[model samples]
Structures are given as C-alpha cells and as structure tokens.
Target: MAISDIKRYTHLTDTDVEALSAELAGIRRAVTTSLGAADAAYIRRTIAFQRLLDVAARLTIYSTRSLAGQLLGATALGVAKSVENMEIGHNISHGQWDWMNDPEIHSRNWEWDMAGPSSQWRYSHNYRHHVFSNVVGMDEDLGYGVLRVTRDQPWRPEHLLQPVRNLLLAATFEWGIALHDLHAEQDRTGTTAEKSALSRALIRKLARQVSKDYLLFPALSGRRWRRTLTANLTANLLRNLWAYVVIFCGHFPDGAEKFTRAELENETPAEWYLRQMLGAANFRAGPVMAFLSGNLCYQIEHHLFPDLPSNRYARISTQIQALCEKYNLPYTTGSLARQYLLTLRTIHKLALPDRFLRATSNDAPETASEQKVRAIHETRGTDGRTPRRRHRTRKAKRQVPHGV
Candidate 1:
C-alpha cells in the first residue's frame, strides 16, 4: 500500500475514537485510585525486596572463588533485579503506581534508583514517544545515527551491514544505548564546551574506578585477575544477549512505517497515533514473558498509555484492539516468535544497500484493494467532537506533575 493510503486506512470513526479515549481515561482513574489506597503496602514490599536483592548480590560477589561463576551469579541476579526496576519498581516510581504520592519521592526513585540515567526514556518513551510516536525526530526508539531501528532515517552507505552492525551494537553497547539519553540531554542543555569538559571528567572518573575495582582490587586481594576478567565478560555477554533479543522483537519489522520530519509535521494527531500503531509491533503476552521482559510485549498499549502501570496492559489490549477495529485503525500485533522472525527479516532486508539506498520509491502505486480500505475511514474527522467526550482539557493534561 502507498504511504498515504496506509495513513488513511487507520483513521477511526468519531464514536470509536471517543469511546477509546474514554476507556483510557477510565483506566487511568481506576489505576490511580487503587494505587493510592495500596501505596503504603506497595512501598514497603518494594523497599524490602530491593534491600534483600542488594544484600544477596553483594554476598554472591564476595563469596565466590571462580570469578566466572561469581560473574554468572551476579549477572543473573542483576538481570532479575533490572527487570523489576524496569517494570514494577519503575512504574511505582513514575507515579504510574500511585498518582497521589509525594512527587519528590517519585522523581527521586525514577531518576536515581529504578530506571537509571536514561531520562530520554522518560521523555521519549513516556512523553514524546507515547504522545507523538512513530513520527521521525519524535520517538527516541529510532537509533540516533547509522543504526536503523526505524525506517525513517535515509539509508547511508554503512547501513549495508545493518543486521551485523545491529547485533554487535546491541551486544557491545546495550548499556551505552540505555544511557544515550543522558548524553543527549547534556547536549541539549549545555554548551558544547561545557558538555565536553563534563564528558572528559566523567570518563576519567569512570576509568579510574574501573581500574581500581576491576584491576587493582583483584591483584591486591590475591584474587585471580584473569579469571575475574573472563567471568565478567562472559556474564555481561549473556545478559546483554537476553536484553537485546527481548528488545529487538518489539519493533524493526517488515511492513513498519518510516517517515521524514516533513511527513510527521504534516500529520494530524489521529494520523500520528495510527502511525505508531502500524509502525510499532507487539509480542506474545503471558505472565512468564511479562516477568522476564518487564511487560514490554504490550508495547503499543504502553506507548498509548505510559502512565498506566504496564501490568494492566494485557487486560486492556482486547478492548483497545476492538476500538481500533471499529475505527478501521491498524493494531499491529503478533506472537513473540513470529514478531522476532519478522524483525530479523527486516534487519536482513535493511542490511542490503539497494533496498533503502535510494529515496524509498512509492511502493508501486497502491492497488485497488488498498483504495477500498482507505475509502472506508476517510470521511471521519473532529467535527463530531462532543462536550462529554472531547479531548481532555489542556489543564487536565498539564495537571500531571512535572516529573511525571
């Protein structure tokens, strides 16, 4: 289908859009009220669990002789804890758990404790990503440069090996990618010179710490340095592999949408929302997968309602899909394995220079079949807005606290 046709295909009827919006608002209110009532118990449990994990991690590190074994144990524990941080703890800290909590505590937990330094994730994933998602320059999920997580970027010469490069980047720079927003924020806020100075200082400090802890400490404590290094490397590789596989399965599939800044700028809010729906992919949903990957499989729902705790996504997805169907909107979803294979195929296709090297030619003008689908939803627009189910007042949107 042509890009314009695809855009038109996802338009929702006024009634359906209003219904979905109301459903979303109801969920937000219900979750917030429940969380408020359960906040104290939730906080206590989170604190206790974190403390136990912290102590256990430290003990595991100190007690093992085989550095490889110790590293493996530590990595396993870290991955588990990180999942909790990303999913449950991060949501709690974001006030997704309880809108009634003190903002200061929520902000602190979000920044320093649970989600780490990826403030971009907050802006990109929570704010811009969910708000203006799938639009080029809006969703931070698109790789910053060279890497093509999204089809939006014009392909470069180096992108010919994108599949290999993506895998390598994921394995080697997964942690770096997680922290990229920190650097982006620094660039946005600080002068170039100031950012450079701070960067140098931070790098020096980190290097010194790594040298002292990873190199000197082992030697001085009479631990086997070589074994320690090997263990750490092996553990990191395994952990990163798991993380990459889980993350990559969400997006980067064939039939995904890509847009330039001009395209995004010209689109309406409803259009942009549809782009996100069509561009983003969802994985299989289940308790085990949710626990392991932090419920990211419900990526579309998460992008739609970032403030609602992720645990509620699976339950609401059916209603969301029904609303989409009623509205003729595209709700892109599939099994985890199926989506993963699709992503791989996309990567393989993107790896070739010819596929994307030229300015993406219009996909052989849209067929009659595509026009039929587009014609169905093309008549709907905002003229049908009603007082009872209009866009939330600007004040309501702004009432969400600053950190949130």
Candidate 2:
C-alpha cells in the first residue's frame, strides 16, 4: 500500500512521500483554520441568492404568458437550480460545510434539487466514486452505465451510436444520474445481486422530484399549470445539460487517466491521492462560471480534498499546482471550451472498438498531451488561424521539463 509500490511514483523515495504528506497536511490545517465567519457567510449568501432567483422565476412564470416572462423565468430557474445542484448541494453533501455543525446546512440533512436522493448520492457519489475514481471496473462514473469512456471498458454495439447516446444522456442527466445509483449493470452482468430495496428507494426519490416539479407546483398554478410545467421542464433540462458538461469535462477530458483494478490493488492514501490527480481534470473559468459549476473547475483540488469548502478551491489552486510540480505530477487543466470539446471528441473516438482491437495499444500508445494536440489540430485547424509550427512551439513552452 505504500506510495512507492505504485508505478507512477517509482521515481519517488519514501522520504519524498513523507514530504508530500507533510505538505498536504499543512494545506489542510491552514484551510481548516481559515474556515469560520467568511465561509459560513458565503454559503448563507449563496442560499439566499438562489432562493430569491427561484421565487422570482416561479412568480414571473405564474403571472405572465409573455415570451419575455417565460424566458426570464426559465433562465432564472435554471441558474438557481444549477447553483443548488452544484455549489450548494453537491459540496454540502461532500461534508464540506459539516464543520460548521449547523443542522440545516449539514451534509446529512441537505437534499438537493436533483432526481436522486441526497442519502443515496452521498453513498454512490461522495463515497464510491471519490474512492474508486477512474478505476475501470470499480468506478461507476467511468461510463455511468451508458457509453464507453475507457478502452478497458468493452465496447458494445450500443456504443457505436455513443455520440447520440451522449447527447441524450446530457439532456436527461438528472434521470440518468438517478438511475446510475441503481447499479443496473451489476445486476445485468450478475456481478452483484439486485438490491431491490435500493431500487425502490431510487424510485421513491424520483417520484418525489416528479411530484414537486411536474405535479405539485403546476397544480398550484391552476389555470396557468401548462406554463408552469413547461417552465419547470425547461429549467430541469438546462440544469441537467449544464451539470453534464461540467462533470464530464472534469473527469473525461483527453488528459484524464483511467486505471485497471490491478493498478488500484493495495492503494495507500497517498496512492489514492495520486490516482485522483491522474484521473481528474480542471478547467480555467472565472468566479461566476465557477460558482455555477460548484467551483468544480478546480477539480484537481476538489478531488485531492473533497470535503474542503468549495469557495476555497480557487484560492488554493496555485498551491496545489505547486505541490503537483514538486512531486512531478501532471496537473491537467485547460480552458473550459477546450476541455469540453476534448471530452466530446473522446466520447466519439471511444465509440469504435478500434482501440480494444489493437492489443499492444494499451501498453504503448499516444500520450495524453499528443492526443490532446491532435484533437485540437483535427477539430480546430479549419479556420486557418494559428499555424501548426507556431502552435507546437507554444505547447512546448508550456510543458515543464521532466524531473523538474
């Protein structure tokens, strides 16, 4: 379980690992001590803003049939729901603000504006996904039971249309996520028993979500029920698409690594951290966009310290990058636009079984950086903008020399 046992850390000595552990401990202590009035106020203010947006959106939709009203209402609702699902709910459920000990804001008590139940999500997402990460067989997030994300995952005929499947999944991401918790694939493959009770729990959770959005609220509008229903659907669709994009970009960009079960055997905490670093990607974004995405743009930091207050992710990103550099680790990051495109391209490429067919391809294939550059050249060079040679020179300048 020692860090040295991991192939990626072969260059590091035990003393080098001790240095990393100490550095990480220092970061945690500093951030933990800094958590107090500012952190609490930030979350409280965010909640209030989200509530204001939700109420305004709903009232506007109920009172007016105008196109402007509907647009405003839908946009506002989508933003509010995005904040709830990402910034508020996801972070809280990671126990980020649990240190405050406020009953309402506590992770255990906070239910999000998604189809999945908070408790179930905490188990599947906070515990399982965080622990297993991109371990091919173990990480449910690898394909979310729909498309082929890694070459190690056997491609099926269904995956031949993954580009279409990926789009549909994004549009209905909330429901997709809710169903993901069911582990239907496990049951189908006979790898595990069907947990009928968990399935029932998921169904009940879906029912509650449907009731709130499609049934209860629309009914409250009486004559305006149609408008309200349409608005709710629009809001949910927007939120789902946004979450899908952000989550996918963070975990499946070209540079993000995947692992086999053998690679994960006897993983120590340091090795676990290393796996997270390899498997996660970050994107460059500003405060507004970051907050909407739950600051998951700083995904490398979030994975390294899941329970850290998300607002602090941006603040500590520089330090984290420095630590990664010191340890000679890849701190994968890019513009949001670039990273998202990379993810989409990856989805399309893996749809074919070509990678699986080339047997030695797994051992000695294109490095992530090469794949990323090739993707960009193929996808973006049509505009006749930056010349290939100039782009290569720029990329070379950006890359840190190995063993630095």
Candidate 3:
C-alpha cells in the first residue's frame, strides 16, 4: 500500500514538480557556494569542544567520589559520545566537509568513536539508506530489520516482541548497527580472504572501542577502577539511547511515508526530492537541542541535501518550509516527544497482524498510498461516479541525473 505515483498522490502536475525541483536545486547551489571559512571554523570548534569535554568527563569520573559528580561526569561523557557519533562522525562520513580537503576531517580518513567501522557505516548509511530513504523492501532502515514499521512489510509472530526489542535496540544501538553492517559485509564478501579481512576490520574496531572505554580508562583510574568502569558503561548506554531516539524520531514518526519500488520507475530528481520531503519527519529543536541531535531534527533537509553542512540545515529548513507552503504540501514535523510517541505507537501497533487493525492498509497512519489522499476529495453524486480532479497520470521526464 506504499505510494507508487508520487505525482498522483500529491496531486501535483509535471510542471509543478519540475519547477519545485529547480527551486530546491537553487537552494543547494546557494548553500554549496556559500561554504567557506565560517563553516570550517564551526566544524573545527565543535571537534575541539567534544575532545575537551570527553577528557574532562573521563577525569572527573576517575577522580571524583561524589554521586553528583559521577552523574555529571557520566552525562557529559555521554553527550560527547553522542556529538562525536552523530554530528561529527555522521556528517563527516557523509562527505559534508570534504571541500575542506583536511585529511584529519575527510570522510575517507575520519574513523568514528563507535563499535561499527565508519567506513562500512558510510557505505551502508549514505548510499543504501539515504538513497533508498523509506522505500519498502529497499530501505533496510525501516524498523532496522526488526520491527514492522509499516503495513506493506508483512506481520510476523516474532514482531510481537518488537516493543521489547525496541528497548534493547535503544540500549545497544551502536552494537545493533555494527552487527547489521557486519551481516551485509559478510554477505557481500564471497572469497574467504575477503571475509577474513572484513572480520578483522570489525574486530579491530571492536577492540579499539572496548579497550578504550573498559580496559584503558578503568586501569588508568587505578584505585577508582570500579567507578571509571561504571561511568563508561553508563555513558555508552546513554549515548546509545539518545542516538536511537533521534534516529527514530526523524524516521518512523507519522507522515514519514513508505513507498513502493514502483515509485522509482523513471523517478525524477523532483520525485526523489518529494519523496525525501514526504518520507522524513522533523521535530522542533532549538540551537542546543538541535546540536545535540546532530541537526537531525531537520531530517527532511538532511535527506534533501545529504552532503550539505549540518549547521546550514536550519536556514535550509525555512526555505524548504516556504516551498512546501507554496506547493500546498504538508511539511511534517512535531515536538520531539510527539514524534517519538508516534513512532512508538507505530512499533507497538504494527507488532500484530492486520486482523486486529481497523484502518485500511492504504489509509493507515503508518502506511498510505495515492488512494488514501485521493479519497479525501472524492465526491460521488447520485450517478455513483466520483468526480475527478485535474491531475497528471504519466511519469515525468527522467532528465535529472540519478544520485549515487
């Protein structure tokens, strides 16, 4: 029941979609050209701040005996990990700062502070996930190979535990992602040598991460080894939970649509742009809240311009919203708590089969297609025939280049 003809679904003509595409491209061009010393300075300052906070938190955890001090230290450390994993690592590996040409900050060279290899995650996230967005059966990120996020994805008995698995995933989000990527890597590597190399890379990453947090930090604490170990565990757990929340808020919330592969048939940049708009939700965020969420609260903008700098998303959002208004399209967003609740609702609701559900597959909150929207204005007279709206049915010209 996922959307197929995006044009018909939105009731936009070919001309309108094309004009919208041009306007969006203009926004990208303006942002791309404006990237300069300020952008570079922002990223550099963020990296420095993250590093300093991390060290200070670790030291506090090692030396301080007060419960309040331990809580503060663990929380600060968790924030550092979140910033590193989401803002810096996620953006950098998206090639956001590649124009800087700084090897230390380049996508190809910057390893992240998570269990997963940044290289593997880059390929999986940037290419597979971003490109596919919310396409059913294509975007593996939908429910993350666990929960049934939409009706299009068939229900299973195992899904009954999705709510429970959701909690477990939140607590160990990094490990879940790492395992997901590792599975993909294992499947792709045909030869024994290739598999061995992939396994070794993952092991090295795991050893580096675990030893840093568990062994090295605790040992360095000496007399306070127990305190340091507990602090590190707490920090990692908090970071994982925050990451999971931010990601789910942007993705599985209501109005973040799912699509059929049929939508991709002769898809235009305009359609892809529209899909990104319709397929990702945003949550309200102020400056601090935005930064902590890695500016992913502006997830619609991020999907629209994935390679653009994260700091610029707020500005891009205003433009995007204006464009949405101009086109009479729904700009899906809500408070952070609201978005997450909607996501949780979908997860729990979809755990059961369709028999228990009342809404039609095409009109459900978590799953809808062209027919749902069309039915809204479909008035049938005494003749028992519905009035038709003036809309384009055929696909648009595939003039835009397919993004990788």
Candidate 4:
C-alpha cells in the first residue's frame, strides 16, 4: 500500500512529491558542504565542558559535607551526565560529526555513557529505529516492546499495567535500553545458546558502567564513599529520567503517527520522507534545552536527517516546516511541556483497552455490485488495466495470522 493508495494527503501529486524530495536533497547537500571548522569546534568544546562539569561535581561532593554542596554537586553531575548522554554520546554515535574525519568523534570509535554497548546501540538504534521510524512492527523503539503506544498495536491484558510500568521504565531507562538491545523480552523464545550469548554481552557492558559509577568512584572518595555513591546514583537516575522524557515527547506525542506494515509495502523514497515527518514530533525550546535534548527538540528534522549535525536542525527547521505546510502535511509540534504531557496521556490512554475505539483501514469502500464488475473486468484485463484478482497466487490469497 503506497502513499497514493491511502489517499490521506490527496493534495500531493507525483510532481509535488518529486519537488519535495529534490528540495530535501538540496538541503542535505548544502548542509554537508557547510560542515567545517565551526561544527568540529562545537563538538570538541561540548565534550570538554561536560567532562569539566563532571569532575567539578565529583570533587565537590567528595570534599564537602554541607547540604548545599551536595545539592549543587548532584545537580551539576546530573546535568553533565545528561549532556554527555544526549549531546556528545548520541550525536557522535549517529556519525553526525564524522564528516570532519575526526577519528575520536566518529561513530565507529565512540562509546556512549550508557548501559547499552555502542556497537549494539548503533545496530538497534541508528540502523533499525532510524530506518523504520514509527513503523509499528519494524521500529522497535515504538514502546520498546514493553508498552502499547498506539491503537494500531494489538491490545492484551498485560498492557493494562503499562502506566505503572512506565514510571519504573523511565527511572531505569538506561538499563531498559541495554535489555532492549538484547531483545530480552524474547529470551524465553530464543535458543539457549543465543540467550546465553546476549546475557553475557549485556552483563559485560553493564559491569563496566557499574564499576565506574558505583565502585571505583565511591571507593576513591575516601571518607565520602557513601555520599559519592548516592551522588552517582542520583546523577544516573536524573539522566535516565530526562532522556526518557525527551525521547517520549519526541516520539509518542499526540500527533506523532504510527503505521501498519500494510501501509509500507513498496514505499517510495519520497513517501519514506513523508513517514518520517508524520511519525516524529518537535518541541519549542531555547538553545540550552536544544543542547540538552541533543537537538531532538527538532525531532521531525532529526528523523528525516539522522546523520546531519544536531546544530544544523534548528537552522533547517523553518524550511522543513514550510515545506510541510506547502505539501499540506501535518507538522506535529508544540512546547516541551505540552508535548511531554501529550506523551504521558498517550501512554496512559493506550495502557488499557478503549472498547469504543476502533482501527480504521485506508482502503476505499466499494459496493458488492461494483466489486463484482471490477473483478470481472480485472479478470479480463479490460481497459488496459491489470487484473487485481488474477495477479495474486492462491498461497498469497490466504491470510496469515495478524502481525506475523
């Protein structure tokens, strides 16, 4: 089912589609050419600032006993950790700065400050999630298989508790991501050897993180071991929660669209761009918030150009929004607070079955008599048209189990 078959955005013609694709390509080419010294300096400076903040926070927490010191240190450390995770780690892993040819900042060489291994994250996130966007079955980021986010997903009794599950998931988002990378939810169905391998890999990655944050840092604090431990825990939790919120706001907001597999069949490149636009939401924020959220505040642009430098999103966003308006497409966006609230609402709404809600198909209606006439005409290949009925094989005609 192509975009044309759906008739959801009937205003766009083939010429308009081509024009849109060409315009986007022009933006990409222009941006690529513009990437130079300034972009490299921005990434380097950010990394340096993040590291300095982390060190200062740790030093303060380890040396002082005052409540003010503890609060300041913990908050600073949390900000540093969140910045590293979102701005430095996430963008570097996306190869956004790789055009600079800096080995240190390259996706292949960078390791994120998270529980999930960089290699595993690239495969699951940069490749799978970016490629599929909000496609229901293909994009694992859609609820991460722990919650039902959209009405298109089949509802089960287990989903009834997702609202409660969401809090815990957000609090421990880094660990959840690690397990998600391993497909831990499907461990029961995996072969023993495969499960064992995945478990070992996850444990090894987790051990490295735990050793640094919990053991090594705390032990090095001398008399303030307990304080340091608490600070590290607090920092990790804050980063996790912030990342979870920002990500949820970008992905599952009220207007973010989700697509069924049927809608993706034989999708064209221009239609693929349309899917990314429809499936991502943006939030209004200042420069500081943009930096903290890794410029995922412009998530619609990010989804469309995942490997483009984060700084470029803001500059390009106005043009992208204008293009959407010209195409008469929905450009889902709002203030951060509104978007976050909408995400929470979506999660809570889909957590339980909505008996009154029903799934709608994109296919157009045809009367039985009209259908019979069309079928007969199609069988005869009349009016120079291919017969829809004769093209499908008997095996292809049989329905498979839903979602399989």
The TM-score values for the models, in the order shown, are 0.71, 0.85, 0.93, 0.85
In candidate 3, what are the lDDT values of residues 159-237, reduced to their tens digit? 9999999999999999999988876667667899987888799999999999999999899888889999999999999
What's the candidate order when arranged by decreasing TM-score?
3, 2, 4, 1
The 10-residue segment of model 4 with minimum total lDDT is 395-404
Per-candidate Cα lDDT values, in order, are 0.53, 0.77, 0.86, 0.76
> Which 10 residues in a row give candidate 3 its minimum summed lDDT?
395-404
Q: Which candidate model has the greater lDDT, 1 or 2?
A: 2
Give per-residue CA lDDT, model 4, range 263-375, as digits (tens).
57887888787778767888888999999998999998999999999989999998897776565555677788888887787687777675744422222110011223333
Worst lDDT run of 10 residues, candidate 2, spans 392-401
Model 2 regions lying over 4 Å from their true place: 1-10, 184-194, 355-404
Task: Give stretches of model 1 more than 4 Å off.
Answer: 1-7, 14-16, 37-47, 61-75, 88-105, 109-116, 120-128, 149-152, 197-232, 254-256, 259-276, 355-404
Clash number for model 1? Answer: 0
lDDT order, best first, reads: 3, 2, 4, 1
> What does candidate 2's lDDT look like per residue over 87-204, in tens digits?
9999999999999999999998998989988777787788678988877677888879788776667778888899999999999999888878666333443433346666777788
Best by lDDT: 3
lDDT accuracy of residue 263 in candidate 2 = 62
- Stronger candidate by TM-score (1 vs 2): 2
Residue clash pairs of candidate 1: none
lDDT of 1 by residue, 1-404 (tens): 22343333333455554565666567657755665445555454655675676556545655676756577556755564555555655565455654546554363444432212434445434554556455566566665444655443556778777777777866755445545545555546548786676456445544664575367635643555655454445545655666566666655544345445554555655454455555555676678677556677776676666667666677767766666544534455567776677667656665555454443333211011234333322433335643123222121011101101
